[model samples]
Target: MESSSAAQSVVETWSAEATSLAGAFRVVARHHPDDIAVKDEENVLGYRELDDLSDRIAARLRARGAVDGQLVGVVIDRSVSTPAALLGVLKAGCAYVPLDPAYPESRLRHAVGDCALEIVVGDPKTVDQCGLGALRVVDPGAGHDGGAPPAGEIEADASAYVIYTSGSTGLPKGCVVSHGNVLALLRHTLPLFDVGPADRWTLFHSACFDFSVWELWGALLTGATAVCVPAETARAPEEFLDLLERERVTVLSQVPSAFRALCRMAGAAAPDLSLRYVVFGGESLDLDLVGEFVRHTAPRPPVMVNMYGITETTVHSTIRFLTGQDLDGKGTAPVGRPLPHVVISLRDRDMRPVPAGEAGEMYIAGEGVAKGYLNRPELTAERFLTLDTDDGPRRFYRTGDLGRETESGELEYLGRNDQQVKVRGFRIEPGEIETALRDHPTVRDAAVIAHDSAQGATLLACVVLRDGEPGRPAEAALRRHLATRLPAHMVPRRFAFLDDLPLTLSGKLDRNALLGLAGAGRNGRP
Candidate 1:
């Protein structure tokens, strides 16, 4: 009887929470109908307009045979219509899959086929390109959602959205996110960042990137304005900074590489601006770059948050807020404690809990845990395993990242275990070497991968230089740079200059491609 009561309570609480988020959307629209809800370079939509447009889009998609629980794909860049399509899909009781407009046709099809997408909602070009049954997401006028369809009561486990993961081996796989996961995340993030109806955010990251999950829902669901930075602008940091200043963007997110470029632009040409929140993800945080940002833009330091997680966990699993005092001893801040509804833990290979300060595989569980990889049940079973903890049948996602729980409850990332190298019986994580190489002033981006050589085993560093920098920083200079920051064995044996580092479709460094290039250029033992 007690167990039954507990289960009933859990169900009731989550059901109420899900409805609360959807209910907020209507309230925000009614209260601040004229407020800017979303702005891309091409268009700016008011809250009232978006609410009505989404309804029409939902109605149109419904007309096109889109049904509840159906998988819908939207192919577009960062734009106002983007959010409208998202709202429409959800209102129609279906999960939406975001596709990058810039991805190659092959990759686009791979995502569509994998998700079994039925209708497409986008411009004519992408609609035909997506090759789904429907051509586009129908745009509805303001103050409408396809006949004010009743917002269905959603269970904690119902699919909320599906984001494609750029698979290392084959085609990309979609990670299923539940409504509960998103709502839990929004509850923590909205208050944590202090975003409200009046705030305006610069949507810098690509829609397909998981970070956009935060940039989009973090605002629309809360009634805050989301300003979409154009692809052309985001591709060029100097241009993006200028547009951001004029747009009055209050929140922005970028990768470390992009942030470095923005700092460079600030040094060359300063933009008049007022930004309150600056967030970063998709890679490790570089304290040096953060320092540069502070030096150039002083007085009120925009809140710098380093978030960590992958597509599977929705948007973020951990975040570290960098303050002036925290920068004293460390070159970089730790990935902070898990948000509410999330539990981050360190575990040994056998899934047993490890003591704090001991490096082990990182596991995350709670409301943020995803529904596993779509259509890949076996893979899901392997990665998202059940934990027999005191919490009872808790689903923990094996992040594959090796992390040590700090004495302060933060997580210190130690790199991937499987990628750890065994050279003459010594385990080495290339991440340590890569991080060291990035310390070099001239290096803008760096990647270190283990390679086999005639001389037994070795590692190589491929680095991209900052523009206007002197001839490639010598390998000796790079080696000396690493020696100072890392142990001798963790230093790379060879360093090469890359005009541009190859990135995966998802924008993360393509390690496999790096290895392939290294293998072709030099003889490395695998």
Candidate 2:
């Protein structure tokens, strides 16, 4: 009866805070103002301080003409200030666009221009480097004169944030997610994790990545402490373990590759840590790594949860908790069941539901689905669909990912239907890498494909040079050229020079043929 009463209280809190992300955080702040809300290596912010700082930042943004429905770009690095900017944007009822300061200027410009972003909040140096003349730049951490701003009267459907993702057209598209979408996601995940103010979640993912949404907001909204993991620490397993231990992190979200690195560093014994939940997402979870992790950890190791999701469907759509038996030298673990309110449908080419156990494109329908790609109605219509269901016309987002339902009704992810690939937990489009390669003067044509080996998948680029285009460029030089235009993950690890790209009889680039060649090149097959 006591447990039932506690469950009822949790339900009531979720229901009351379901209106908006900001509102939910506000509720927590009001209830627990003195509690530590967020902590980074540089600083720690209490709930009251976070609320007060964000309110001041919002007041400053409003003074500078920021209004509801406007999109604000945040080009700051990972820190406590980042969340302040995000919450401030919400306080002004504007959607905040997260931009990594490390991203190429060209890519940044495209995202800023695509959204017609007027105001960007960041450090003064980073803001200046953005090079948007018309952009109104503000340092959210700068001192404010007037009192705290009034809380925004934001509606549930208002745009909360826009996260740009790789597009097949060699550009990034912004997915405008609503406050209600985020609320729904938190609603489903909180109960699953049994999260509360006592938990400490790590913000291990980049601010631009969708996973950070779950990390940052998930903590603040639930009155939990969010500990920021430094970029260098996140990449280095020893440092990450130290930070996790020092912070006493209870919830840790990581990609399979990174977790494997951590396990390799930790060896046979699990370090004494307070981790209760270790969630995996962003890429396919390796069963071998999962098995190794289970063996290395203590008898009551952290519960491993695999979440399958996309940017279009907010951060997560489905989740599966893994047990030691689930990783008993079997195939891949299923992505588990859909969130309570979410509807998952496996549809064929004709948009008809496929039979049980058959592969089909996964379609997500529910509150977590985004409003659509910003300013790209045609593409939005192509991906986000409205299908007739038994109840009525329901909206769905085509994930472009292939999956099959298991006997237990869990979704097992198949590969994508397109050139999109996940390398080191980052979703990358081969077209983007190909486009960058084509930009080089020595390269006439280029095709990029992911090559999988014992060390996992690495990108390989096939290049065709222009006639008499100077001396053949060194692979190192070509990589340097791509580095200026693309992120490290998107850059090809190996390059193969080809006289011409293989083409299908349909006159399209034959990706399968290219993959075969890439595999042979990787294996030193002549």
Candidate 3:
């Protein structure tokens, strides 16, 4: 926790003025009552209208027994009503837990039951399907009388929301983030993008993902317009592009895989876009794709930023503004420097800071770190660490992501520690192989995975070829091409051609599904 001048400056200069989500949003709503706040394809809600709807919903929630520090389940799709429900939950002095209507009944039941939720604000039919008959379901669009109480005030440390992430053990764990955590993230990020009332942001990710927390709050709190992308359109890159153009979206954020698909859909010519900044997150960004995108675009398309973040650390931790030079020379694009008021440490297995350019586990500390997992104290204790530094006692979240610091103090991401593979006694990172596969002229997208079965550990390469390309590459041809740059053992032993790789709800590569596709048994044995 030794203080760098940059880190110290961040701590000294920045402090959140907003105490609650509803409180901060009210300031914007009052300032720009006539500006459009939330919109979808069919409907638009001005700032005043959205605020009034949320206030009404808050009154309903209070009547049903919601109180300060309680959990309120929000089970709505990506519509204008969704933001109203979220803000309504906060106004009721409760933390909103997003329950996607598209999720399975079993997962939704587990989320509600595990949290002991008593009230849900969403579509009534979806609530019934989830078997939440005992709990009260308040529709976001319901009418209410004019006797709504004043929006309650909340402490900075009170939980704002709970987002569940899939755990290694099969069950999902909820991350509890405070209002101050999100306010700090918004304060640091909005300035970087120069967000304002004139900007329009697209909520492209699912409500359950932490990325949506940034997408939604960053726009609403800034008095900017937040456009909701439909579920069907979000799945198709071509359709997504059309939505962006039609909405005149200025600030956009997408997973690297999804952006790569957009580039493929456009081919060599970049469409005229109104975007000013396009942020890539939720997965490793392939520099090859970055180069491809730059090639198709005009002299200057949008400012491309690669950000690395974890749900435990709010949404984003680092931000790097990528340039043409980054596209020209790189293995993987750097994740950029730490955000203001954030500290990054690369520590080895012994908990000692690693020397420069050596890979180690990343530990993030400062304003962005979350409170901890909801009901898993043991897991929280293991991941969240407290260390004494010259500045003071600092709490750090172990990211489990291995990375090294560059000479310029930026972080270069290596693959995940668990993803490091040992094949034929040689340690290999699948990202490097994936990078190699992407360099091939015929390949458009690629994923490399390691599978261990009765036949022993083998590397598998799954790829999608470019349109108008001939049949899939032969296994021998791919292996031969890989051998030119990689060691024999690092080359994949088997290859599978797929039209596209499976992605998780967050749009990251679904390695578990890839393992299953590779013919590995449930226990990882053939």
Top model number, lDDT: 3
Give the TM-scores of the predictions, in the order they appear.
0.88, 0.80, 0.93
User: Clashing residue pairs, candidate 3?
Assistant: none
lDDT of 1 at 185: 78
lDDT digits (tens) for residues 1-526 of candidate 2: 0123322344357567557777777777887899999989989999999998998888888888887789998885768999999898888778899888667889889998898888898887777876764588878889895545555457889999888887888888999999889888877666767667888999888878888899898888767899988877876688989888889999998865457567766563367788888888876665656776766666757888999888889899998888667888444567888988699999999999999999999999999999999999999999999998877899999988889998988898876778578889998877567656766767656778888866588888888775665434557678899999888888877778776667432123567798888767742223
**Per-candidate count of clashing residue pairs (backbone under 3 Å):** 7, 0, 0
Sorted by lDDT, highest first, which candidate order results? 3, 2, 1
Off by over 4 Å in 3: 1-17, 145-147, 268-270, 520-526
How well does model 1 score by local distance difference test? Answer: 0.73
Cα lDDT tens digits, model 1, 1-526, are 0123322332334344455334446656776789888887778889888887877777777767887778888776667888888877777677888877677778778887888776777776556654543434443332344455445654556676888775656767789887778777776555566556656777767767878878887776666789887777776777888987788787888777567667778767756667777888877777777776776667755778888887777788887888777655435557787876688878998889987689989888877888899999888999998888876878899988888877777887777777888766678877777666666777777878777777667777877777877544366677777778777777777666776677654456778888877777642213
441 in model 2: Cα distance from truth in Å? 43
Model 1 residue 494 CA deviation in Å: 2.4
**How well does candidate 3 score on lDDT at residue 346?**
88
Superior by lDDT: candidate 2 or candidate 3: 3
Superposition TM-score, candidate 2 onto the true structure: 0.80
Residue 197 CA displacement from its true place in model 3, Å: 0.9
TM-score of 3: 0.93
